[model samples]
Target: MEIMQSLTDGIMLGGIYGVISIGLSLVFGVLGVVNFAQAQFLMLGMYVSWTLWKLLGIDPILGIPLTGAVVFIIGYLIEKTLIQRILKAPPVAQIFLTVGLMIFLENAVLLIYGSSFQSVVVSYQSLGFHIGSLFISAPYLMAFTAAVIVCAGLWIFLSRSWFGKAIRATSQDSDAAVLCGINVKQVYALAFSIGVALTAIGGAVILPYMTVSPSVGGQFSILMFTVVVLGGLGNVAGALVGGLVVGIIQSLSTMVFPVQLQNLILFIVFIGILAFKPEGLLKEK
Candidate 1:
């Protein structure tokens, strides 16, 4: 039963990681850009949730829409004002732009929030339910559920909606999509916006499990990037799978390896995957 509880906890954590990484995959898929600044977006979402819950007394769940709306608009504006102009330039431009964005957002956030760590002081977090004699934190369960809904919504948007299809078409071949009267630039902007919004949602949902700090976004960025690559760049399903696999590895490592070395286990697996199947388990169309 102790073992069972640990396994359950591992799976729950992995679900959150997988959900968080999907946005990274989506942005890479459509924009052909490695958005190093994704961490800042995650931070923004978390900060908003912290603000709402810790400051305004709103629940974190209720803050989702507020965070999402803010990040979505910021994403759209960022792309329109800066990213769109460099779409046709070399890929290096995207990298540089993203790096610049990383510095800007980080510094801006520090100036706004300062270095003080923030957390939502909720008493319910300590409360947990036992399944088969294993304790499960309420926050992990909540995070898992929220992550699923958000990812499912993204999948539906990509598979069912016309604009989603347009994004897909553009991802496959932007020139061909253009011939079909799809506005490639518009699709890119919207896709970036949606992708950033995903990270925001993740931040808001997982705040209960994590403390808010400027540097935390950088940590999320690395984890999400690993998930994106393992899942395959541009492959949403692959990212999901990759996220779960990473979560499992991380969870298991706590038992088998030293606490400090747990992160290394994930790196070993990720490198193995990259070497064995660079395209990922599920290749996007």
Candidate 2:
């Protein structure tokens, strides 16, 4: 029964994990750039939602779209101004650029919002339903449900929209896409924007359950990267699977490992995966 409960909770948590990490996969898929600052965008999303709630009384879940839109614009501008310049640069340059940006964003948020943690109260914040002996958290359930719905809509948008097709083509072969008049540069910006937007939405939905702080992004950065890598970098579908696996690992480990060691376990797994299955568990062996 304990194992069952852990599994259930893990799956619920994994849903949010998947949603937040999918953007990383998408960005790599389309732009071939690993965004080290992706977690900062998630932080930005949380702040956006928190601010909207504090000022206008809008619920975080209800403000997800708006949060996403705002983040998308910010991402677009950043891509155009900074990321684009590094697209053709060496991997070291790309990594440093994003890492630097991450530091900047973190400090900027700290300066603006202070270092204190902030959270929002919602009607369902403390609500939960019982399933036999298992208790399901309302916040987790709602966040998971919203993630699924959003992912479904995103899949449709990618498959049916012209821009989506263009993004896909660019991802496959930017040179070829350019020859086909796809405007690879524009597609790159669009893909980055969309990626960050998705992450922001995930952050917004999880706001009710999670506290927001300037440094919150530091906590999720490795976890998000782990999900993307486990799912196979640049594989959107793989992120979902990776997230579930990570969630389960995290949840079950709590039974045997100390709280401080949970991250050690994840780091060990991450190293093992890189050494043995760097292509990711979801990829064809």
Candidate 3:
């Protein structure tokens, strides 16, 4: 019974993970650039939601769209000013660019928001439902549900919208997309902006249950990358699956290992996946 509950909790956690990973995957899928700063945008969303809640009494869950919009603008401007310059640069240059951006953003937040941790208190924070002898946390369930909704929206936008089709075409071949009257540069910026916005939504949804600080990105960075890589860096469907697998691994590991050692197990799995399946489990052959 305990093990089953843990698995359920893990799936809940994975829902948020999947939402965040999808953004990362999309950026790579569209632009072919691995953004080390992606998690920082998650941190950014948390801060935005936290501010809105503290200042105007907005519920973090309810403020998800706003949070995503704010992050989307920031992402758009970033892609235009910084990421665009590196689109054709060496991969190493791209890595350094994003890593530098990550450090800068973290420090900028520290300067603006300080080093103190901030969390929101919601009515549902401690609420839960009892399914037979198992317990399901309300906040987790809410976050998971929100993630699913947002992911579904993303899928629809990517598959059915004109801009989304252009983005997909750009991802397939920027040159070909250009010949088809698509603005590849604009598509890159839009995709990256939307990607970060999605991640922001994940951050906003989880705010009721998680704390935020400038350094919060560090906590989830490895885990986020693990999910993306496991799902195949640019594969959206794979990210969702990887997220569930990672969440299960985390929950089940807790039954045997100490809490502090939980992430260590994840790291091992990440390394193993990279060593054996660099292309990821869901990558199309």
Candidate 4:
């Protein structure tokens, strides 16, 4: 029963993890740039949601669209002004640029929001339901549901929309896409914007169960990377599978290992995957 409970919790947590990591995967897939600053966008989303809750009396969960929109605009501007310049630079330059962006975002948020931690006080923050002996957390369930909806929507957008098809074409071969009349630069900017927006939405959904601080993105940075790598860096569907695998590992680890060692275990899995299957559990599309 205890194991079953952990599994349930893990699934809920994994769904959110998958959503957050999908943006990272998408950015890398389309741009061929590994964005070290992606998690900061998640932090930005959390702040957006928290602010809406505090100032406008909006529920954090209810403010997800606003959070996503705000972050999406920020992402679009950043990609156009900053990332677009480095798209063809050497890998080291790209890495350094993103790392610098990550630092800037962290300190910028710190300067504005200060060092205080913030969280939302939603009505269902502490609520839960039981199915026999297995308990499900209300916040987790809501976040998971939202994550699913967002992912499904993304899949439809990517697979069906005209712009989505253009994005896909650009990802497969930018030069070829250009020859075919697709605006490759525009696709890059849109893809980067959408990628970060998805991550921010993930962050907003989890506000009920997590606190937001400037450094919170640091906590998720490594986890997000692990999920992306485990699923395959550019494989969107793989990210979801990786998230489930990671969430289950984390949940079950707490049963036998100290809470402090949870990350240690994750690090081990990450290392093992890199060593054995660096291409990831899924083949790149």
Per-residue alpha-carbon lDDT of candidate 4 for residues 1-285, written as tens digits (9 for 90 to 100): 899988988888898999999999999999999999999999999999999999998987788889999999999999999999999899999999999999999999999999999988988999998889888889899999999999999999999999999989988999999999999999999999999999999989999999999999999988999999999998989999999989999999999999999999999999999999999999785
lDDT of 2 by residue, 1-285 (tens): 999999998898888899999999999998989999999999999999999999999999999889999999999999999999999999999999999999999999999999999999999999999999999999999999999898898889889999988988888888899999988999999999999999989899899999999999888888999999998999888998898889889999999999788788889988888999999988722
Each model's C-alpha lDDT? 0.84, 0.92, 0.93, 0.93
- Candidate 2 all-Cα RMSD: 1.2
Clash total of candidate 4? 0
Candidate structures ordered by TM-score, highest first: 4, 3, 2, 1
**In candidate 1, what are the lDDT values of residues 1-285, reduced to their tens digit?**
655665787788778888777888888889888888987899989998898886688777667888898899999999999888887789888889999998898888899999898888666677788765778788888888888888888889899999999999998999999999999989999999998988888899889878988878877776787788888899988888888877877777777788788667767776777889877777665
User: Which parts of model 4 are misplaced by more than 4 Å?
Assistant: none
Least accurate 10 contiguous residues by lDDT in model 1: 1-10
Candidate 4 has an lDDT of 0.93
- TM-score computed on alpha carbons, candidate 2: 0.97
lDDT score, residue 109, model 3? 93
C-alpha displacement of 170 in model 4, angstroms?
A: 0.9
